[model samples]
Structure formats: structure tokens, C-alpha cells
Target: MIADTFLIVTLLAAATVRGAAPLVLAALGGLFAERSGVVDIGLEGKMLTAAFAAAATAAVTGSVWIGLVAGIAASVLFALLHGFACVTHQGNQVVSGMALNITVSGLTVVLGYAWFQEGGQTPLLAPGARFGPIELPGAAALASLPVIGPIYREVISGHNLLVYVAAAAVPIVAWLVYRTRFGLRLRAVGESPGAVDTAGVSVSATRYMALVGSGILCGLSGAYLSTAHHASFIRDMSAGKGYLALAALIFGQWRPLPTLGACLLFAFADAVQLRLQGTPLPFVGVVPVQLIQAIPYILTVALLAGVVGRAVAPRAIGVPYVKER
Candidate 1:
């Protein structure tokens, strides 16, 4: 019984890490964009586009690397368009973002039907075409250790390459946002564009840089969704993950460490919900999976609804920069 309990706990923890991977990456993408004064509501659309691009490219070439590149390119292109609309043209950020979401939602389906003729899914990729999990060195040998062994193996290892990249990005982003000159300018621009402009820092340039990073990360998140987490793309497969990521960004107070923690909590709740599917509790008597699935959203809503604290967004966010003639 002890062994079984340990096994279940270990599995859930591993699954939580796995599930949090995309959220962390996507939330990071949104965080950077927002920090630079561009509210990126189009993350869902960009992710969906990248997922389709990756899956289709991989299917054609049977090369995951090429697919990844294609995915990033697609997402970057979309990000640029969002930048053009919200930053250059000074359009409504939320509307422009939702437009992209609607556009991709329809476009992917139309394209999918044309390409595959069997609904909005790409061809199922072979395991070789997917980003398989890596087994860390010394993990097998360390599995014999009592507590540390299982924790390390389950939580610290067994994820695909992108998971580690997302984890490592936390510290890198923290340093970039807090310790670097460009980071200081970026944060300042988000808070006070007028001050940054007076300092001779191009607000457009800084925000554009943020969008670039945002696109790359979102691309990774999308590609990982279709290629690593699953074998192919399905219509709307992003499934509002982008919004959940945004929620995490707000709930985390737009900080990297707190965002990471939020992602983990959301992922943990999701993992537990999945594990509880069709399982009966003493008084509950076999709760429905749909109800279980709602837990994360409910928690996020509670957080956003002032159960935590006022969500302090960047002051200059969603505002376009116009220079004096």
C-alpha cells in the first residue's frame, strides 16, 4: 500500500510538471509582451498557427527540427502582424488579438480540410517525428535512493528538451528584466513611455524586441503542444491555454517567479483532476470529469476576481506610443 501510494504521488507530480510546460512557456511569452506595453491577447491564435505549421511541416519532411523552425516562423509572423496593428497603427489591442484568434480559428479549419480532408487535424506523426522525452544522465542509478530518488526522477527529469528550456528561462528572464540595461528600458517603457522617450530610448524598438521574444516563446509552446505533447494538430487544440497563461501572468503579478509558481499550481490542479477522473470519493461518489476539469479555471477566476489582490497591470500597456512632431 505504501508503495502504491508513493507511485501515485510520484506519477501525479511528474504529470504536473509535464502539463505546466506549455503554460510556463506561453505565460512567459505574454509576460514579456505585456511588460513592453503591448497586451498580447492573440497568443492563442499564434500558438494555434504554430501548432498547425509544425505538425504539417513535420508530416511533410518527417523532421521535427524543421517543423519547429517552421512553427516559430509562423508564430513570429503573426506576432509581427499584432505589433503592426496594435503598436504601429494604434488599434485596439484586445480587438486585434481576438481578431487573430478568430482568424486562425477559421483559417486552420479551412486549411486543414483542404490538406487532409478528414477534419481539422494533421497526419498523426510517428514517435520519431515527435520531440521525445530525454532521460537524464545518472537518473537510473539514482532511482534506488529513498526520497530524493523518486523526486528527482519524477520532477526533475523525464520531460522533453523544451520543458528544461522553459524552466531555465525563468532565471534568464529574471536577470534580463531586472539586471540588464535593456531590461530596465523595457520595463520603464511599459510603465512610462514618455519617460523612456525623454531618455532617447525608442519605445517602438523596445516593444518590438519584446514581441520578438514573445513570438519565439509562443512558437515553442505551440510546436510543443502539437509535436511533443501530442503527435498532431487538432482544430483549436490550443484550447484557451493562451488565456490560462494570461491569467497566470495576472495572478503572478507579472513577475517571473510568481508566474512560474502559478503555472505549476494550475498544472497540478489539472493533473489531479485528470487522475480523479471516474474515481469515487467516500461522500462524493464518483465526481464527473467535466466538473474536475473546471477546477483550474475556477481557481484562476477566483484569483482574478480579487480573492488575491488587485491585478496591477503595466500602466502604459495597451497604449500606443505617438511621438511629437
Candidate 2:
């Protein structure tokens, strides 16, 4: 009984980590863009575009690395477009982001159908084309041990490479944001681009750099979704993960570690919902599928409502900087 209980707990924990990986990546990407005063409402669009690009490319090229590169490149292009409108043309940041999102939502479907003709989805990726789970060293040997063995083998091992990447990204992003020179400039630009400009820093340049980082991270998130989590890129595969990530960012007050915690909370809700589907309970009996599906979103709304008031965004976020004469 104890062993069965441990196995179930480990499985749920692993699922929670898997579900949270994409959110963590997307939220971290948003952190960089928002920290530099750019409101990136197009994270969903970028992820979608990247997912389609990665899957299509991998299906054609039979090389996952090449697909990964294509994904990053596509995301970066969209990020640059966002930067161009918001920073260079002095357009409404929100409008620009929404336009990108709307455009990608349609464009990817159209292109997918035109090229693959599989009802707006890329071909199912073969095992070689997908990001396969990697076993940690000694995972097999350690699996026979007691309590710690199951945790290490099931919870710590057997995830695809991007899962580990997402775990590593948190500390790296924290250091980049709080312990680096560029971080100083990023925070400064977000708070007061005028001050940064007065101090001889190029506000446009800093924000652009931040957007590049944002693009790379979003690319990774999208790639993970299609290549690691699912076998192919389906229409609207990103499904609102980008928005959830933004919510997590706000809930964490735009900080790295706190944002990760919020992501894990949402992921836990998601894992529980999956486990509860079709399962009978003492009082609830078999819950409705729709209600079970809504659990994560409901939790998100509740958490955001509670924290939004206390969570303050960067001062100059969404405002385009004007250089003084």
C-alpha cells in the first residue's frame, strides 16, 4: 500500500513538473520583455508560430535540432516585429501585440492546411523527430531503493531535455535580472527610460535586447509543447498558455522565483484535474468533465484577483520612450 501510494504521488509530481515547464519558460520570457517596459501580449502568438514552425520543419528535415532552430528564428522574427512597432514606430504596445496574436492564430492554420493538409496540423513526428525522455545516470540502478529511489527515478529523472532546461532557467534568469549589468539597465528602462537615456544608455537598444531574450525563451516553450509534450503541432496548440504565463508573472509581481511558484500552483491544479477525471469520489461522485477541465482556469482567476491589487507592474511598461532633444 505504501509503495502504491508513493508511486501515485511521484506520478502526479512528475506531471505537475511537465505541465509547469512551458509556463515557466513563457513567463520568464514575459519577465524580460515586461521588465524592459514592453508589454508582450503576443507571447501566445509567438509560441504558436514557433510550434508550427518547429513541427513542420522537423517533419520535413528529420532533424529535431534544425526544427528547434527554426522555432527560435520564427519566434525572434515576431518579437522583432513587436519591437519595431512598439519601440521604433511608437505604436500602441497592446494593439501591436494583439495584432500579432490574431495574425498568427489565422496564419498558422492557413499555412498548415496549405502545406500539410492534415486539418491544420503538422504530420505526426516520428520517435527520432521528437524530444524523447532521457534517463538520468543510475536511474535504473537507483529505482530499486526505498523512498528516495522513487522520488529520484520518477520525479527527478525521465523528462525530456527541455524540462531540465526550464528548471535551470529560473536561477539563470534570477541572476541575469538581479546580478548583472544589463539587468540594471533593463529595470531602469522599465521604470524610467528617460533616466536611462539621460545616463547615456540607449533605451531602444536595451529593450530590443530584452525582446530577443524573450523570443528565445518563447521559442523553447513552443518547441517543448509540440516536440516534447505532443507529437505534432495542432491548430491553436498553445491554447492560452501564454495568457496563463502572463497571469503567473503578475501574480509573482514580475519576479522570477515567485513567478515559478505561481506556475507550479497552476500546474498542480492541472495535474489534479487530470487525475480526477472520471474518478469517483465519496461526495462528488464522477465530476463533470467540463468542470474538471475548468479547474486550472478557475484557480488562475481566483489567484489573480487576490494578488492583482498587491502586484504592481513596472512603472513605464507599455509606454514608448521618446528621446529628448
> Each candidate's TM vs. the true structure?
0.95, 0.95
| Tens digits of per-residue lDDT for model 2, 1-325 | 8878778889999999999999999999999999999999989999999999999999999888899999989999999999999999889999999999999999999999999989999999999998999999999998888888888988899999999999999999999999999999999999999999999999999999999999999999999999889989999999999988888888778999999998888788778778878788778688876776565566556656774356678999999998977
State, as a TM-score between 0 and 1, how close model 1 is to the true structure: 0.95
> In candidate 1, residue 166 scores what lDDT?
85
Model 2 alpha-carbon miss at residue 80, Å = 0.4
Tens digit per residue, CA lDDT, model 1, 1-325: 8989888999999998888988898888888899999999888888899999999999889999999999999998999998898888888989999999999999988998899876889999998888998989988999999988988888888889889988888898889889999899989999999999999999988988899888888999999899999999999999989888888888888999999998998888788888987888788698887876676677667777878666788999998888888
Clash counts for the predictions, in order: 0, 0
Q: What is the lDDT, from 0 to 100, of the residue 93 in candidate 1?
A: 89
lDDT of 1 at 316: 94
